[model samples]
Target: MHIHENRPGVLTALNQIFAEQGVNIAAQYLQTSARMGYVVIDIEADGDVAEKALLAMKAIPGTIRARLLY
Candidate 1:
Protein backbone atom coordinates (compact mmCIF):
# COMPACT_ATOMS: atom_id res chain seq x y z
CA MET A 1 0.00 0.00 0.00
CA HIS A 2 1.10 3.55 -0.76
CA ILE A 3 -0.28 6.08 1.63
CA HIS A 4 -0.69 9.61 0.37
CA GLU A 5 -0.80 11.15 3.82
CA ASN A 6 1.79 10.34 6.43
CA ARG A 7 -0.38 10.13 9.50
CA PRO A 8 -0.95 7.81 12.42
CA GLY A 9 -3.04 4.65 12.44
CA VAL A 10 -2.78 3.75 8.76
CA LEU A 11 -0.39 0.89 9.43
CA THR A 12 -2.47 -0.19 12.39
CA ALA A 13 -5.57 -0.26 10.23
CA LEU A 14 -3.86 -2.35 7.61
CA ASN A 15 -2.57 -4.77 10.20
CA GLN A 16 -5.99 -5.01 11.78
CA ILE A 17 -7.51 -5.91 8.44
CA PHE A 18 -4.97 -8.67 7.97
CA ALA A 19 -5.63 -9.96 11.44
CA GLU A 20 -9.37 -9.92 10.89
CA GLN A 21 -8.96 -11.87 7.69
CA GLY A 22 -6.77 -14.45 9.43
CA VAL A 23 -3.78 -13.61 7.33
CA ASN A 24 -0.34 -14.28 8.72
CA ILE A 25 2.15 -11.55 8.11
CA ALA A 26 5.54 -13.09 7.52
CA ALA A 27 7.35 -9.79 7.15
CA GLN A 28 6.70 -6.14 6.46
CA TYR A 29 8.60 -3.13 5.21
CA LEU A 30 7.61 0.48 5.60
CA GLN A 31 9.04 3.81 4.58
CA THR A 32 7.60 7.26 5.13
CA SER A 33 8.36 10.81 4.20
CA ALA A 34 6.59 14.10 4.80
CA ARG A 35 4.22 13.54 1.89
CA MET A 36 3.79 9.81 1.49
CA GLY A 37 4.25 6.38 3.01
CA TYR A 38 5.00 3.04 1.39
CA VAL A 39 4.43 -0.41 2.80
CA VAL A 40 5.22 -3.88 1.58
CA ILE A 41 3.73 -6.70 3.57
CA ASP A 42 4.66 -10.32 3.10
CA ILE A 43 1.83 -12.57 4.13
CA GLU A 44 0.80 -16.18 4.22
CA ALA A 45 -2.83 -16.83 3.44
CA ASP A 46 -5.27 -18.48 1.13
CA GLY A 47 -6.06 -16.64 -2.09
CA ASP A 48 -9.50 -15.56 -0.97
CA VAL A 49 -8.25 -14.39 2.39
CA ALA A 50 -5.44 -12.41 0.79
CA GLU A 51 -7.86 -10.78 -1.58
CA LYS A 52 -10.17 -9.90 1.25
CA ALA A 53 -7.32 -8.38 3.21
CA LEU A 54 -6.21 -6.38 0.18
CA LEU A 55 -9.70 -5.01 -0.29
CA ALA A 56 -9.87 -4.02 3.33
CA MET A 57 -6.50 -2.34 3.10
CA LYS A 58 -7.58 -0.33 0.09
CA ALA A 59 -10.51 1.01 2.06
CA ILE A 60 -8.26 2.57 4.66
CA PRO A 61 -8.01 6.37 4.57
CA GLY A 62 -4.93 7.81 2.84
CA THR A 63 -4.25 4.61 0.93
CA ILE A 64 -3.29 5.70 -2.54
CA ARG A 65 -3.02 2.16 -3.88
CA ALA A 66 -3.02 -1.45 -2.76
CA ARG A 67 -2.29 -4.55 -4.78
CA LEU A 68 -1.09 -8.11 -4.42
CA LEU A 69 2.34 -8.53 -5.87
CA TYR A 70 3.28 -12.06 -6.86
Candidate 2:
Protein backbone atom coordinates (compact mmCIF):
# COMPACT_ATOMS: atom_id res chain seq x y z
CA MET A 1 0.00 0.00 0.00
CA HIS A 2 1.05 3.58 -0.67
CA ILE A 3 -0.33 6.87 0.54
CA HIS A 4 0.08 10.57 -0.05
CA GLU A 5 -0.23 12.58 3.09
CA ASN A 6 1.06 15.92 4.28
CA ARG A 7 0.94 14.57 7.80
CA PRO A 8 3.61 12.09 8.78
CA GLY A 9 3.20 8.39 9.70
CA VAL A 10 0.28 7.76 7.36
CA LEU A 11 2.46 6.47 4.55
CA THR A 12 4.50 4.34 6.89
CA ALA A 13 1.39 2.77 8.31
CA LEU A 14 0.15 1.97 4.82
CA ASN A 15 3.45 0.43 3.87
CA GLN A 16 3.44 -1.76 6.93
CA ILE A 17 -0.05 -3.02 6.20
CA PHE A 18 0.83 -3.91 2.62
CA ALA A 19 3.95 -5.69 3.72
CA GLU A 20 2.05 -7.76 6.24
CA GLN A 21 -0.31 -8.82 3.49
CA GLY A 22 2.45 -9.63 1.01
CA VAL A 23 1.26 -7.11 -1.59
CA ASN A 24 3.81 -5.63 -3.92
CA ILE A 25 3.06 -2.18 -5.18
CA ALA A 26 4.25 -1.60 -8.73
CA ALA A 27 3.65 2.13 -8.78
CA GLN A 28 2.08 4.79 -6.65
CA TYR A 29 1.01 8.41 -6.79
CA LEU A 30 0.44 10.67 -3.83
CA GLN A 31 -0.66 14.27 -3.71
CA THR A 32 -1.70 16.48 -0.85
CA SER A 33 -3.25 19.84 -0.15
CA ALA A 34 -3.73 21.85 3.00
CA ARG A 35 -7.11 20.28 3.38
CA MET A 36 -6.75 16.65 2.36
CA GLY A 37 -4.63 13.87 0.89
CA TYR A 38 -4.91 11.49 -2.05
CA VAL A 39 -3.38 8.10 -2.84
CA VAL A 40 -3.32 5.89 -5.90
CA ILE A 41 -1.75 2.45 -5.94
CA ASP A 42 -0.77 0.38 -8.94
CA ILE A 43 -0.18 -3.25 -8.21
CA GLU A 44 -0.36 -6.64 -9.87
CA ALA A 45 -3.98 -7.77 -9.65
CA ASP A 46 -3.61 -11.32 -8.48
CA GLY A 47 -6.02 -11.55 -5.57
CA ASP A 48 -8.37 -9.70 -3.23
CA VAL A 49 -5.40 -8.06 -1.58
CA ALA A 50 -5.94 -4.86 -3.55
CA GLU A 51 -9.43 -4.46 -2.27
CA LYS A 52 -8.37 -5.27 1.27
CA ALA A 53 -5.49 -2.87 1.07
CA LEU A 54 -7.72 -0.06 -0.17
CA LEU A 55 -10.20 -0.74 2.55
CA ALA A 56 -7.49 -0.77 5.16
CA MET A 57 -6.02 2.52 4.03
CA LYS A 58 -9.42 4.14 3.71
CA ALA A 59 -10.02 3.31 7.34
CA ILE A 60 -6.89 5.07 8.49
CA PRO A 61 -6.66 8.63 9.75
CA GLY A 62 -5.76 11.45 7.32
CA THR A 63 -6.73 9.33 4.35
CA ILE A 64 -9.33 11.00 2.19
CA ARG A 65 -9.52 8.04 -0.21
CA ALA A 66 -7.79 4.96 -1.52
CA ARG A 67 -7.91 3.21 -4.87
CA LEU A 68 -6.20 0.32 -6.58
CA LEU A 69 -5.22 0.44 -10.25
CA TYR A 70 -4.63 -2.76 -12.08
Model 2 residue 65 distance off true place after TM-score fit, in angstroms: 2.6
Query: In every candidate, how many clashes are there?
Result: 0, 0
What does candidate 2's lDDT look like per residue over 1-70, in tens digits?
3445468788788877778888887776777777566666676655577777778878878765566554
Cα RMSD for predicted model 2? 2.7
Per-model C-alpha lDDT, please?
0.83, 0.70
Off by over 4 Å in 1: none
What TM-score, over all chains together, does every model reach?
Answer: 0.90, 0.70
Which candidate achieves the best TM-score against the true structure?
1
Question: What residue runs in model 2 are displaced by over 4 Å at the alpha carbon?
Answer: 1-5
lDDT of 1 at 6: 82
